[model samples]
Target: MLRFAPSPTGDMHIGNLRVAIFNYIVAKQKNERFLLRIEDTDIERNIEGKDKEIMEILKKFNIKWDELLYQSQNINFHQNFAYKLLQEKKAFACFCTPQELEIEREKAKKEKRAYRYSGKCEEITIEEASKRAEPFVIRIKKPKSSIKFEDILKGKMSFDPNEVDSFVILRADGRPTYNFACAIDDMLHDITYVIRGEDHLSNTPKQIHIRKALGYTKDIIYCHLPIILNIHGKKMSKREKASSVKWLLEEGFLPEAIANYLILLGNKTPKEIFTLNEAIEWFDLKNLSNSSPKFDIDKLRYINREHLKLLQEEKLAKLLGYEDSQIGELAKIYLEEASTLNELKNKIDKIFNEKRDYKDFEKEANILKENILEVIKNSENFDEFKKELMKKSSLKGKQFFKPLRIMLTNQEHGPELSKIFPILKNKIEEVAKWW
Candidate 1:
């Protein structure tokens, strides 16, 4: 089993989406069950409706999961596990106050040493703690030896016992901490594989410790993908506009194009461009690079443009609010200047919605504009049409071509009229009468 566990805290980050894509693709490649686990246990930080927003985004990306679960719903199981650890003396309750812990932390800072938990409550007996009125938190007993595991991507990893102090399993308010709940849920779901961001690397050992303490012997395959950096070479942050998947979609990026770009990042692919379905055939976690990959908007735009070209002409026309397949072909002419669906649509919209006043060459331009339909109908091609239109207006050189150009395309400069007039011939009446 594989899972993409996201916290319901904010907008879905692009990095997280990439992780989801990797997990989903790997699950398909392995023929394993995939699941989405919303770690909504941090009720204080979770935003309302964010979980639904996450589901909507997943749907947009076509990432179907076999199971959907919220971490909060397993509160009973988490509590039960915590009690089990306490009963076995593997964990104990601590009555330390926040202020008291801070003072010890400050003393450690002054002494230039790491602040390890003092384990002051390790001697507190269960019956003695049950009789006490003070609020306390359950903390797992610190491991005596190093915690080690082999990450599928990062490879052999180890953390010393001193690095992992006795950490809280259940908070004073009875809510499970992130690592505790994550470990328990993975064990409960029998998750055999975990593909996630490199930010979770440090938390892996802690989760492993939790599982070991619970006597859960099964091991989960871990692949920690490299961090995605911005163009400035800094870690991508949610504060950046391009970091949000919703922002990218609103900006007119095709979902498939985004998936293609992400899969190509930090990994070797069979080809430069491919669909999500194509990726599943060859994607392997072992092939991924450990080096961080930079998020390039220009690269994404290039990929989106290619994906656009791969669309059916009729479907491309529909995206631009047209039914004619020729209109779709006409839209492709502007691909040199437009990279996104919105930009392409704007280019097509200008053809049918622009108002041409013919102010500079009012008489000459108007004469050609008025006779455009008749001249175009009579002539089979642009050269023939231009020749006949000039003859009708008795105009030549700049006077002849400038007004004709404005009258036809409503712009003084653009793609040569020769290339445009052919595809646009059938739509001439609409273009001329648009004003």
Candidate 2:
């Protein structure tokens, strides 16, 4: 099984969607079970509605997990495994207080050396340590030799055992740290593949140690995905504008387009537009690049336009802020060149908003302005009126239609003059001939 674990701390950044996309696609390609587990161990940081909101977002993205779990539900289970390590002599309770550890850390800084935890409590007997009423946290005993594991994307990784100290497995408050909880849960869930962002590689050795200490012999694969970076070449921040999944959905981006952009973020697949199923068919760990993918908003807009072109007229009409069934005809004309629904809104806003300038075909626009009232005053057929107006003005080609376009829409280019006429309705007379 493969699992996606998200913390219910705040709004999910757009970057989070890629992790789910990779996991879901991997699960489908491998024909294995996919699961979702919410890591809500830090209750202090948990926000109300975040879990529900995340569920809705996943649903919106069409990511369906075979099994769903809450890490908070397994608190006792994790604590028991920690205690088991203590019983097996694979772990020990550290009685060092915060102040004592802080002093050692400061001393390490002053000595210009790395801070490895002093094994002050490593030799303490379990019975002796258990008898103490003072608060304590469990720490796994790091083996003295080098550790090695094979990453699916990055192969044959070796870690110096000295790089990691005897890190805490459980806090003094009896809650599992992220590494400890993740390891135990993976083992419990029988997860065969662990795919996630590359930043978590530093924590892998610690998790592997916990697994070995707990005697979990099952094989588990690891795949670290490349990250999405900001302009500074660091991980994209959640605070960045328009970075939240919720915000993008609210801004009228189709979920399919977001998925398309995300899959292509680091993979460099030739095809930029694809559905979720297509993405699954193309998902390959080997194709992923080690370099961080730059988040290109313009590329996202291009993807959005591709999706907009495929939308049904009724759906496009709704997205265009028009409920009129006739707007479907309008959608068909403008959406051909529009990149976003907002851009469509701007193009059509002139029908309802105040008019600006009409600079094109000045002489032809002048003729149309002078006689358009006379044409409207006497004729019921637009074809008859436009034919007569053009003949009377002795203009042809763009010189002829250009005036009609500028006089009606105030823009040099748009849908054919015939289509925009319906949008102008009775407001055409409001336009002055003086300009």
Candidate 3:
């Protein structure tokens, strides 16, 4: 099984959406059970209704799951297992108060050394602690040596036990800590692979230690996805103007394009435009680089323009809020330079009809005699009309159509004249006289 575990702490950022896409695609490709698990244990930090907002964001990306669950609902499940470890002597209760721990940390900082837990309560037996009836937290008893684990992506990584102390399994407040809770969930759920951002790389050895301490041997592998960076090469943040998925969709970015761009971010692919199925066929997650990948917004726009080409005229018309097929027709023509649907709207508005405001076409229009308007007003089809204008105006080539095109649409070069009149419905007289 694979799971997309996101903390409902804030708006689902673009990086989170990318993580979900990676996880969802892997699960889909393997035909495995995929699920969403909200790590809401840190409930105090959660924004109001963020859980609901997260769900909506996932749906917007077509990230469907087999089961939906919360870590909060399974609090006792994590709690009970933590106690089991405590009973097995794999973990022990700590009686050190916050002030005492802080003092030790301050002294360590003064000594210019790393702060590992003092293991103050290691000698204190559980029976003695229960007899005292004092409040305390559980800490896993990690050895004072190095811990090693193999990563599918980074390969053969090691961490010092001193680098990671015997971390708290249960907080003094009786809430199971993240590493402890996540380990229990993953083991119980039979998650064979843990595919998540490398931001969680530090947490891996800790979780691995917890599972090993539990005496259950399961070969659970991990694929640490690279961290997504912003344009400034910093971690993506809302303060950095890293857009949310909702905002991208609102800006008229195709969801397919967004998905494709996210997948391409530190992974290899020969082509830009691809369906999710194509993505699965092309992407090999184990071979992905461990380097941090910058979230290139410009690259996303380029890919969106590619997907825009795939859009059917009828569908493209509806997306632009146009009932006329001419808008879609002209949109495809303008979309060669369009990155998003809003840009398409601007381009479509340009040629859906002529520009009455900008009369830069006046100079171009002056070159064509008033007699050309008479021919244009009387002509039926575009071909016959162009012939009449050339014959009467005594002009041919760009000298003829170029000025006529400028007068009609106010653009130097644009949609074909044949397609234009059908779109504009023949206001050549108004166009010529107004200029």
Can you give the TM-score per candidate against the true fold? Answer: 0.95, 0.85, 0.84
lDDT (tens digit, per residue) of candidate 3 on 159-277: 98876688898988889999988998898888877888888999988888888787768877788888788878888877654457767887889988998888888877878679777
| Comparison by TM-score, 1 against 2, better one | 1
Query: What would the per-residue lDDT of candidate 2 be over residues 298-324, giving only the tens digit for each residue?
Result: 788789888877777777778778765
Among all candidates shown, the one with the greatest lDDT: 1
- Candidate ordering by lDDT (highest first): 1, 2, 3
Q: In candidate 1, residue 8 scores what lDDT?
A: 94
Provide the overall lDDT of each model, using Cα atoms, as 2-decimal numbers: 0.89, 0.81, 0.79
Best by TM-score: 1
lDDT of 1 by residue, 1-435 (tens): 899999999999999999999889989988999999999999889999999999999998999999999999999999999989999999999999999999999999999999999999999989989999989999998898999999998889999987878999999899999989999999999999888898998888989999999889998888888999999889999999999999999888999999999999988888998999999988888888999999999999999999988888898999888999887887777777778989888778777888876667887876666677788888888889988887887889988888777766666766788888987788877886764
Report the number of backbone clashes for model 1: 0
Q: List the residue pairs that clash in candidate 3.
A: none
The alpha-carbon deviation from the true structure for residue 366 of candidate 2, after best TM-score superposition, in angstroms, is 13
Task: Please give the lDDT score at residue 121 for candidate 1.
Answer: 96
